[model samples]
Target: MYAIVEIAGQQFKVAKDQRVFVNRMEGKEGDSISFDKVLLTGDGDNITVGAPAIDGALVGAKINRHLKGNKVIVFKKKRRKGYRVKNGHRQALTEILIGDITIDGKKKSDSKKSEPKKEDKKAAPKAAPKKEESKKAAPKKSAKADDLKKIEGAGPKAAEALVNAGVDTFAKLSKKSSEEIKEILTNESSSLAHLDPETWPKQAKLAADGKWDELKQLQDDLNGGKA
Candidate 1:
């Protein structure tokens, strides 16, 4: 059986045990969630679709995880004017497994019962160390790289070069001079010159100075302004 359900104000077609990811949602892994905005449902011979959303139909799912999507590079440039722009995006996403789809409030079973096996505690392996590994303290650790990738115009290569040049953190990036960063980029890869001239340096500077809120706000403004 299949059903179309709405989550986070968006609609999806789903089936039992099917996993899907949508816009980031406020739930932790292993949490149960329900959707009342079931738009359509069907089982072999019967079909039910809503004028907008089906009444009395509920879809239940379990949150599998909340994660970010793959990095996407956005590069913009105009010929010969030294006008260039670059950005990157890693969209937040939530993964869910559709469990049950109900029609007229009657739920369909998602699995078949299986016999339980007896536990063999004696065969269990011994537990290992739980403490985390520690590294030498890095006093120069700059916050500049906290989320340089979040700027929406950088890539793994840029990030690597930045880190290699002591711009490993967001705080460091924001504090460094634009000329310095540009010089580093030029020395590392002249290709970076294609980035948005007006905003990249400004954003990097803002991030270095610990003006994170402003940094995000500026990114949003740039996006909204179609920069």
Candidate 2:
């Protein structure tokens, strides 16, 4: 029997006891690891394919060794600019021996499935109280969301993310620390990961207090919303 599996981002057709070199992987030599991303499996005339990947299927392997591949040289030059660069790179790789492929295996999701579904039954009754609480909280929600873009580093997307996360008003934002705001932005999207929130809380505080003059002065001194 042979199985097609993905390991370290690359796919390979492997059989029992077959050795293959792949991208560097974690774990020491002789460590046994299993790849659950079995795309396809075949046993003579019978073939089983996956929708993306077969659930509960596994390809077992043992790490043989870790080594670097042959180095490749790269040369670059800019004519008339008198600039030249030469570089060499060696790819780190690991040798693994395929052990056995199993079609029926225990999946991580199986345990989650075994978890008692009683929570769903209990959650139904709690929904009514939550509705009543939301009705009572309507006044708080009626307050207009602040234009967080006024803060030096926050953009339209950042403002929208804050609003969705319940930090809609300047008062709410000012109460949060820079680290908290940074975490929020990172959890929202990876594209906003590079934004600096170091000065956000202070700027929000000024805005929340309606000190436009001081906020403008602070923004003028800031470099791209950074201190």
**Each prediction's TM-score against the native?**
0.47, 0.48
lDDT of 2 by residue, 138-222 (tens): 7677557778889998977688778879999899999999899989988986556778999999999999999999999988767
Clashing pairs in 2: none
lDDT of each: 0.69, 0.85
**How many collisions between residues are there in candidate 2?**
0
- Candidate 1 Cα errors over 4 Å, as ranges: 105-225
Candidate 2 is scored at a TM of 0.48
Candidate 1 lDDT over residue span 1-227, tens digit each:
99988776467889999999977776779999989989899898888878678767889999999899999997776678897788797877889999988775433321211211112234422321111112223333442236656655665556666777777766566566657766776676554544443455677677667687987877764642235
Quickly count the clashes in candidate 1.
Answer: 20
